[model samples]
Target: MYGAETWRTTTTTIKKVQIFINSCLRKILNIHWPDTISNSLLWERTNQLPAEEGIRKRRWKWIGYTFRKSSNCIARQALTWNPEGKR
Candidate 1:
């Protein structure tokens, strides 16, 4: 799915990884993971916050275990690697 000059597949892959990561994070964080099968915006927004912040803030103990896997990737893509880009 890697088409020329398009990050659609990359973005989609990142999103899916994000969803699965969020699910596992919720379970590990002692939060009740939900299984509702509706498309209500209210439920959607409600379910998004904790996981969003948790990821953003790196709020997990097991995160330390994954730091090794993420560190190199993050460093490679980080703004410092592209000085012209905003930090």
Candidate 2:
């Protein structure tokens, strides 16, 4: 998630990230093979946020940061830019 702030996320991407995180958490918790844990429980135990929420937070935080930058910033302009185009 290092550059997640610039990612164009979709359902599949988010789900893949979540699955990877869940597997890592399970390994870290030594819950393997016969052991099982619900996703909600795992999140609760680790105080973790889902991929979607985490990425969304990161994106929003980045957006806010960009907004706080000088008006001439390219990132800030990109956020407020509404191109005159058609679908």
For each candidate in turn, give its C-alpha RMSD to the true structure in angstroms: 11.4, 1.5
Top-lDDT structure, candidate number: 2
lDDT of 2 by residue, 1-87 (tens): 899989999999999999999999999999997889899999999999988999999999998899999989988899899989798
Query: CA lDDT of each candidate?
Result: 0.45, 0.93
Query: Which ten-residue region of model 1 has the weakest summed lDDT?
Result: 1-10
lDDT of 1 at 60: 45
Compared with the true structure, what per-residue lDDT tens digits does model 1 show for residues 41-78?
Answer: 33364465433344434434334434445546763245
Q: lDDT score, residue 83, model 2?
A: 89
Q: Name the weakest run of 10 consecutive residues (lDDT summed) in model 2.
A: 78-87
Q: Tell me the deviation in Å of residue 78 in model 2.
A: 1.5
TM-score of each: 0.29, 0.90
Q: List the residue pairs that clash in candidate 1.
A: none
